[model samples]
Target: MTQAPEDAIDVDEPLAPKFVAATHDATGEQVPTRDLSELAPPARPARRWTPKRVVITPDALDHPHAHRIVERVEARGIEVERLRANRLTGVRGATERETYALAKSTMAIVVSPPSRRKLQPIAPSADWRVDLAEGCPAHCQYCYLAGSLSGPPVTRVYADLDDILGGLEPYLGQGTITSRRADRAQEGTTFEASCYTDPLALEHLTGSWTRAVEFFGQWEAPVQLRWTTKYDDVAGFVGLPHAGRTRVRFSVNCLPVSQRMEGGTSTVPDRLAGLRRLALDGYPVGLTMAPLMPLDGWREHYGHLLDLVEAAVDGVPDLDLTAELITHRFTPGSKEVLLGWYPGTRLDMDESRRTTKRGKFGSTKYVYPEDVMTEMRTWFTDELARRLPELHVLYWT
Candidate 1:
C-alpha cells in the first residue's frame, strides 16, 4: 500500500466552520428568529416496521412498560406470546439465512438488569455508551452489528430502563467529553445512546427512548445525550422540553448506495427532511455520513448529497450543525455473518479492494487503501467546508 498524501483527512480531527446568513437590525446588530418555514421540506415517506412475532420474557409479563408495549402491539391486531424466563423458545430455521431473517423480524421484550461492570467507552462519538436497547430490526446489507451481539439477533428492548439511566449518575463530570482538553471545560459529560441499536426504530413500540429524552430534558446538568438514527420517527420526540441537551444526527449516504445497501430504512431525502424538522425545532442537529463507499463516480455521488443537505438546512436560525464522517470498514466475522444473511447481496466486500487495518482489542478489518481513503476524505472535508461554512466536523474515522 502507498502512503497517503500530506493533506489527507486524519481520524478524530476537529474542524469548526460557520455559515449563517446575517440579518442586521436598525442598530447594526444581527437579529435572527428560529423560523424555518422558508426552507421547510415536503413530507417524506415513512417506514412501517411491523414485527412478525413478539415474544415476552416471563419477568416482563407484568412490567408496566411491557404492558404498554403489548397494548400498542395488540391494538394493531397482533397477538403476543410468552417465552421462558431465560430461553428463546423457537427462533430457528432450517438454513442459516432463514434463521437470520426470522430473528430480524422478531421483537423480544425482556427485563435487563443494570450492568454491575463498568460502562463501555465510545470514543470519537461519546464518553460512555449506555444502551437502552440491544438490537435493530432494519435489514441493511451492511449491518455491522451482525455478529457483534450475543444470543440470537432478536431485537431486545429493556423493561428495566429506570435502572439504566439511574446508573449514569456516578459517571457524570468524569468522561472524555469534559476532561479531554482546556476547551471542553463546559461540556460536563456526554452519553452515546445508539451505540448498539437505532433508537427511532424501537421508539415506536417501546416508547423507551421518549422516556430517556424526558429524563435528560429535566436533569439540571451540563450533560448532552447523543444518538443518530436511520429512521425519521420524530413525532414522539418533537415539542418535548429538551433544554438543548440532545443532538439527533441522521445517518445518510448517496442515493444508489443507500437504495442498494440499506433496506427497511428511510431514504436520504426523507432523512434530510427529518433533520430539517428537528433543526427547526431548535435541537442541535448533525449529519452522520457513514460507511462511506467510494463507489463509481464517487465525487458526483457525495457532491449531490452535500447539495441536498445545503438546500434542506440553509435558512434555519441558530443552527448548530456538525458532521461525523466514517469510511466503510468490515471485519471477517461480520462479513461471514452478512454473507449468510444476504447471500445475494451486491455489497462490495471484496478483500482485493480493501486493505487490512488493525482495530481495538487486536481486531483487524478491511478498509480502503491509503490512496483511496486520502482522495475521498480530502474531497468530502473540502466540499463540506465550502458548502456549509457554519458546520463543525466533530470527527472523521
Candidate 2:
C-alpha cells in the first residue's frame, strides 16, 4: 500500500485533535490526546462557551438518533435545555412545529435515502437519495447544501441505521430498470450521496457509508452507489465489502481553487493519492471536477491537474478510471447564503450570462459557451484517451 506523503497537504491539522478526542470519549475510550491527533481530530474544541440554554423540542427529541446526538452534545460539558413544543416559539424563525419537524427529519436518518421519485424520469437514476448528515465538517465555499438546508453548519450523525436500511430493502430487491430514453440507458439507478455531507469526514463516527457498502455488496441488481467527497481519508474503505456496487468518487478542482475556496478540505494532491489507493483496492473510483470554478489561466490550471491525475495512477494495472465534469450553478438562496458565508468571495457571480429558471434558479450564463465547451470536451477527452484509453468518461455535465 502506498502511504500518503509526509508533505501532503494537511487540511485537518487545525481541528484533528479536538475531533479525535471527542470521538474517543463518545466511544468510551480513554485515548491520550497525542494519540488522537495521529488518528483523527476531535469534532469540536475541548473547551467551548456554553449557551445559557441549549434547547431541543419534544418532536426533535422523539427521533432516537436525535436524542442520542443531543445527549452526546451535553456529555461534552455543554449545558443543554430540552424544551417541549411550548418553548419552541421563543427560539426563532418558523413555528415550533415546523422547526421541530425539520430538525427531526434532518437528524432522523443519518444517511439520506435516495429519492426514488426522479426529478428527470427519462434518465437512469437511483431511488435512494441518502443524506447521512448535513453541513460538512470541511468548509467549501461552493457547497450546494448551503441553499438546501436551514441552520448553522454542523456534522450531525444519525444513529438509527436499522430504520434507514429497513426502508431501502424494497428498492434494492428490484431488478435493473433501465430508463426509456436512449441517453439514460447507459447510466442506471444513481445514488447521490455527497451532495449535503462529506461521507468520509464522519465515517469514523457513523460508519453509515460502510454499512451502505456492505448492503450494496449483497444487492442482486446493477446498482450505482455514488459518493462524492473532498476528503482524503480511505482507511475505512481499504478492504471493505464494496463489491464494485459503490463508486467512491473524489470531487477535485484546480490547485488554486482548492486552496482558496475549499478551506478545511483535503488538498488536490492528497485527494488524488486517496483515489489511487481506492483504485488499487478494487473500488470503482470516479473523478469529479465539479462546479469547475472559472479562474485566471483556467486552461493552464486544469492542464496541470490533468497531468497530476495521469501520473498518480498511470501504471496501476487493475484500476477503473471514470471521470465526470460539471460547471457551477447557484440558486438565489444559495447565492445569498454564500455571500454571507464568504463576504468577499472572489468567484464571479455575473448575472447577464445566467438564465433565470423558475425565478430562483441562477447559473453561469454559460460556464463555457458552445465553442469553449466543445474545446474543453475535446481537450479532456483527447488527453484521457491518450493517457488512460481503457477508462470510461462517464459524463460531461
Candidate 3:
C-alpha cells in the first residue's frame, strides 16, 4: 500500500540470444509451423472516442496543434467550442453520476504555461514526467486518475509541446532507473509521458503526441521518452524516426482482469500484438503487467498471459524487453470517486481484507495483504525468469 518504491529488482541484460523457430517438424517438408503474424491476435478494430464536444482556450486558439485537433474532430462531425476565459463549462448531467460520465467524455485544448509544466521526478519509471496531455479517455473501473485530477476530468491536450520538449534538456543523465542492471537497455535519462494520461488515446485527436514523438526522434541527447498505453493505436507513430530513443510500453493484464475492469480500451491480445508490431519495426518495446490481482485461478490466467507475451516477441533476437509489475493499490479518495463513477463495480477494495500503508505524502492506501503480495511477487518473478529469461523486470509493487 505504500506509495513509494517497492521491490526494485535486478534483471540480467535484456537480449535474447536467438529465436528457436519451428522451421520443420520432422521430414524436410518445407514448412514453418507458425509465422509472426499468425502468432499475434488478428487486426484490432478501431476504438471510437466519445468526446463529442471539444473546448479550446484563447491561448491555444492560435496554436497549430489546436487547429489540427479541430480539423480532425470536426471532420468527424464533433462540435468545437471556444472558451473565452480559459475555463471549461456547459457540460451538465441529470445527476452526479451522469455529470462525471459527461465530463469524462469531453476534450479540452489548452496551452500549459511554462511555469505550470515544471517537470517532476517519477522514480522507478522515469527520471522525470512529461505530459503531452493531462487526462485519459479510458474508463478503467479502478480509475487511478479519479481523485488525482482537478476539475471534471475532461481530456486536456497541451498545445505548447514545443515548450514542453524544450524543457527536458536540463535534466539529462541524472535519473534513477529500476537498477543499474535491469535497466541497462535504456542507459540515459528517461522522461515518462503517460503518467497522467495515455498519449495514444489522445494521439488521433491532437497531434501533440505525434509532435512529441517526432521531437524525441530528432533530438540529440541522452534521454529516452517513455510512455505506456492500454490503447493499440500505433500506426500513426510506429513509422516515426524514433532512433531507439523512445520506448513504447504496452500496459497489459490477464484477459479476465482487463475484461472485468478496463473498459473502452483495446483487448489484451491486441495490445500484445501492438508491442510485437513495434518490436518488429526495431523500436524498443516493453510490457507493463499492472494492477495485478490475485484472482481465482490467477496462475492459469497469468500463465496464459505470459504465453501470449512469449508469442508476441519470441522471435525477435536481441530484443529490448522490459516489464513493470504493479499490484493493485488504492487510496480512500480514489475509492470514493470510483464508486461514484462506477457504482456497481466489482473491484475488490474491502478495507478489512487489505493492509494499510502510508505514502511519501503521508496519504494512506489499501493494498493486498503481505502474504498475498508475497505469493504473487514470487510466482511472477520466478515465472518470468523461467519463461522469458531475457526480459527485464523494471520493478514490482
Candidate 4:
C-alpha cells in the first residue's frame, strides 16, 4: 500500500489508538469475530471518473464556488477529483446493489461548500465540528446543500473513517501545547461535523455519529465534538459513550417555516423534545436557529419558538443554551443553483442590497435592518439571561 506523505500525518509524538472494533452476524450467516487490530486498515480506494450515458453539460462541474471546496480539501493533504455524475436519481430508489457499487468505486470526493459566502464568525463556541456523513436526506426549501451538492441528495458516509482517524492520531496529543500560551485562554479545539451533511438523518443506518461519540470520549483535553441536524432520531444517542464532550445540536425553525419550507424534516417541537431527552441523559445539548427566515409575522414566529425552547430545556442540567442565528443570504451563483433545485422556494431572492464579488453574493439584505438585529439580540440575551443566568451565552453573530 502507498503511504500518504509524512506531512499528511504531521506530529512528532505517537498517540494512543482511539477506535475499537466489534463484530456481528452478517445477514443470517455467522461471521468470524476479530478485533480491528487483527487486520491492517483498509487502503484508500481508487478514484474513477466514468461518464454516464446522459448528456453532459458544462454547468455540471462548473460551479463558481468550487474553488472554496478545493482549498479546504487540499489543505488536509487530500486531492479533489471532479467526476461528471452521468445519472441523477433519488437515493430512495437506488437498489442495494447499486449503492454497494457506488461505494466501492470511489475514493475521497469533494462537493461545493454550502451556504452564504461569509459565515459570520460567531465567537469561538463549538469545540469540534464532527463530520458524520456527507449529505442530508431532508429537503428544506432553503437548504444550503442544494447549492453545495452536484446531484440529488444522497447521504454518503466516508467508509474509511477508521483510516481517517488513524491519520488524525498524531495531532491528537497536541492539546497541551496551547496550555502554555499566555495571552490566549486555550480551550479544546472545536470539530464542526455536519458542515456538509446532517448527522442524525440517516444515522440509524450508518452508525457513524455513534462511532464518533465513542471516539471523542477518550481524548485527554476533551475535544468538543459538535453535530447538528434537523432530524429527531434520539434512540441511537441514548446512553452512548458521549463522555460529555459530544454536543448534539438541533437545527430548528419556526413552525410556519417548518410547515412551508422544510420537507421530510422533524417538527420544531419534536426536535426540542429530543434535545430535552439528551440533556436529561447528561449529554451536552445545543439549539441552532439558523438561516433565520424573514417572512410575514416573523417576530411572532420566532417569539413562539423562543417560548417553546424555554419550556423544554429551562431547568435541564448541562444544557448548553448557546444558540446560533443566521439570516437568509445567497451568492448569485448559488442562487441560480438553489432556484434550479427548488423552483418554488420562497427564499428572499431580491438581490438589491447584497454584497457582490467574484463568485459570492448575499443579502446583507437584512430581513429587518440593524435596529431589528439589535432588538432581536437584546430580547434573546435578556430572556436567556433571565431564564438560565448561569448558562453561557457562547456566541451571537
Candidate 5:
C-alpha cells in the first residue's frame, strides 16, 4: 500500500510524528526535532549511605521534620538530594554488575505513613509492628531484609513523628495472645519498632528511637515498646524515663559468627557493655541470639557468649531480662538473594543439611534437622537455666 502524503491526512486523523520531519532552513534537509522529555521518566538522585547521600521525596522535602533530618544529616557532611517519589523507580543500572552493586549500597529518604494499623503482626515479641525506619545500613551477610525488600537495602526514615507516635493510642489496651508474661507484671499493647530497620544505626541522624523511648515513658497506658538491634549505642536511651515500658533487646551471636557474618555492627563487647549500662540504669534488657548456626564447636562458643551475658548483668539486681533464641534458617529465594548480595559469605546455607518445613506465613524454610534442633534446644535451655537462671526465655524458634 502506498503511504499517505503528509499534508493529505484527514482532519480527524493525525500524521505519524516519525513519518514527518522538520526541514533545515539553510540546507532543506529533513531533520528530526521532537520533544520526548514528557515520555521519559524523571531522573533520580544518586543514592549512597555512608559518606552519606540522602534523597528526599518532593512531598516530604518541605516537611518540618524533613528539614530537621536533612540539617542533622548534612551537619555530619552528608549530601542530601531532594527529588520526587516517582523518580525513585527510575534508579537502576543498565549493566548487570552495576545493577547488582547499586542494589547493595544505595539508600533513599522518603516520607511514609506511620504504622497506623497492624499491617502484619510480629508475634512472640510484639503483637503489632512499628517502624522508625525501613532499612538497615549494616551489611550483615544473612540479613533477611535482603529478601524482603526490593532493590538494595536503603535506610529510609519517615518524617512524620507526631503521626507515628499518635497512631499508638488506639492500640493501648490491646495485647497479643502470647505477649503477656507473669515475670514482669506487665500486660498491655506491645509494639515492635525495629521490625525492618536498626534504630540505633539511624539514631544519630533521625533520633526517632530516642523520641520513641520518651514517648513510651510518659504514656499513661501500660503499653510496652520493644526493639532489637545489633548496634550498641545505648547512651541516649539509658537516661530516658522509660518506666519499664520500653524493652531494649541487644542482638548477640557467638563471637565467631558475628565476626564472620556481621559487618559494620558494634563489637560483641561494646554491645554487652551497652546492655550492662542499660540494665544498670533501670531499663529492662534482653539478649537475642539470632540465626543460631550450628557451626563446629558452636556449643562452646555460644556457651562462652552466655557466660559473657551473665557477667554483664551479673550485679544488676532484679533485672527484667529476657532471651529470644532463633536458629539459622533460610528460604530458597532468600538464599539466592543473599548469595547474590554477598558472594563471599561464609554462612552455611547448604540445603542438603536442612530439613524442609512450612513457616507460619505459608512460606517454605530450611531449618536444622530434628535431631540437631532437639540438641540445640536442650543445650540453650539448659545453658540459660544454669548460667542466667533469672533470665526469661521468651521462645525458641
Candidate 6:
C-alpha cells in the first residue's frame, strides 16, 4: 500500500478498524452459531459545495422569515427541499463523502425555538452569546466549527428571530468588561452575535442580523452588540439607526492567507471596504485579525495587510476602530475534521512544530512555539501601533 502525504487525508478510508466474525470455528466447515459482528462506526463523509439546494422543515414555514427565505430563494430559481422535521437527517450523507460535502454547503432554514438554557458568558469581550444561526456556509480550511459543530455543518438560520432578540432584554447591563480594554467604546455590557455563525452571508436569506441591528439601534442602554464577519455584504446595515451600539468587526488576514486558506469568503479588500463603509456610516467598526498564521515572510505579508487597512480607512474621520489579534491554533478533533473536509488543502497544520496546551474548555489545542508566538505578538502590536495609530487593539489572544 502507498503511504499518503503527512498532511493529506483520505476521507473515503475509514479511520477506525472494522470487526468481522469468523465464519468457521476450529474446522474448515462454516459454524452455524457464528454471526458477523459490526464494530467500527461509519466513515465521515467529505464536505462538498451545495449552496443552491435548500432544506427547510415544514414547521419552518410557520415563521415569517421562512416565507421570505422561500420566496427569495425561489425568485433566484433555486430548489427547495421541504422535509419533515424528523426527515431532516436524510439530508446528511450516510456512505459517500461527497454527499457529506453537499450537506455542509446546503442551506437549511431551521424554524426551531431558541435554546431555553441560560445564555453562556463570554468573558474579556462580551457578557452573553445569542445564536441566530448555528453553522456557516464559508468553507474556510481552518474553521473552528469543524469540531464544535455536529455532523454535516449545514448553515441554519433560525426562524424565531423576534423571540431571540427579545430574550436579550433581561441580559442587558449584566456583562462584565476588561478595564484595560484598548477601546472603551465597547466598555459596557456586550452581547456577541457571531459566536457560532457569520451573519452577513445569511443576512440576505434570513435578515435576522438586520433586525438585531435595528433592535440595538433603538435600544437605550449601556449594552452593546458585537459580531464579526469575513463577508462584505453591508448594504442592508449601512443606513440602520445603530445609535453607536453595534460594533461591526471584520475578520481579516494577510492577502496570501486570505486568498489561500479562507475559502468561500470575501477577499481581503472587500472586507476592508466593508470596514471603511461601516466606519464612514458612523458605526463603531473593528477588525478581528484572527488565525494569524506564521507562514514564510509572514511579517512582510502582515505589514502589507496593515498598510492596506491604513489605506482603506485612511482619513475616515473619527474612525472608532478596534482590533483583536488571534494567532492560528487548532484542537486535535478539529484538525481531523478539517483534514477530512479538505484533504488536498495546503494548510500547514503540522503538529510536530506546535506546542500542546489545554484550552479553557479542556480541549487540547496546537499552538505555535513560544519564540514564534512572541515574535508574532511583538510584530503585530508594533506594526499596528505604527501603521494604524487610530485603531485601538482590544486584546491579543
TM agreement with the true structure for every prediction: 0.87, 0.68, 0.86, 0.63, 0.82, 0.82
- Looking at candidate 1, the ten consecutive residues that score lowest on lDDT are 11-20
Off by over 4 Å in 4: 1-130, 170-187, 353-372
Candidate with maximal lDDT: 1
Per-model tally of clashing residue pairs:
6, 26, 0, 13, 1, 3
Q: Which RMSD values do the candidates have, in order?
A: 10.8, 10.1, 10.5, 14.4, 21.2, 20.3
lDDT of the candidates, in the order given: 0.77, 0.57, 0.76, 0.53, 0.70, 0.73
Q: Can you tell me which runs of candidate 6 are displaced by over 4 Å?
A: 1-50, 94-96, 112-117, 178-186
The TM-score obtained by model 5 is: 0.82
Weakest ten-residue segment in model 4 by summed lDDT? 46-55
Full-model lDDT, candidate 5: 0.70
RMSD of 1: 10.8
Off by over 4 Å in 1: 1-38, 42-45, 113-117, 182-187
Candidate 1 lDDT over 191-236, as tens digits, reads 8899788988877677788778778777787787889999986655
Please give the ranking of all candidate structures by lDDT, highest first, separated by commas: 1, 3, 6, 5, 2, 4
1-397: candidate 2 lDDT, tens digit per residue: 1223323423212232222221112222333322223223123211111222334555445456555555544444444455545223332325544433333222221323245222222112233465555556565677677667766543445544446645554554233333223443444455656656778765543457877777766665556667887877766565565666678888888888888888767778778877866665566787888777556787789889988888777655457677777777676677777776677787666656554444334432224455556776777788778877777776775
Per-residue lDDT of model 5, residues 1-397, tens digit only: 1323424422113212222112222222224334332322222221123523567788676557777777766655567776746256534578544555554454566667433333456776676788767888787888878678765555678776656787778765455533454643364678889888887777767768888887887786667788898876665564456766778889999988898888878877778776776665566778888979888998899988988887777666457899999998888888988887778888889989999999778998899999999999999999899888788888888
Quantify how close model 2 is to the true structure by its C-alpha RMSD in Å: 10.1
Task: Score candidate 2 by TM-score against the native.
Answer: 0.68
lDDT (0-100) at residue 335 of candidate 6?
86
lDDT of 3 by residue, 173-208 (tens): 665562233435344778889988987787767767
Cand. 6 TM to true fold = 0.82
Measured with C-alpha atoms, the lDDT of residue 143 in candidate 5 is 86
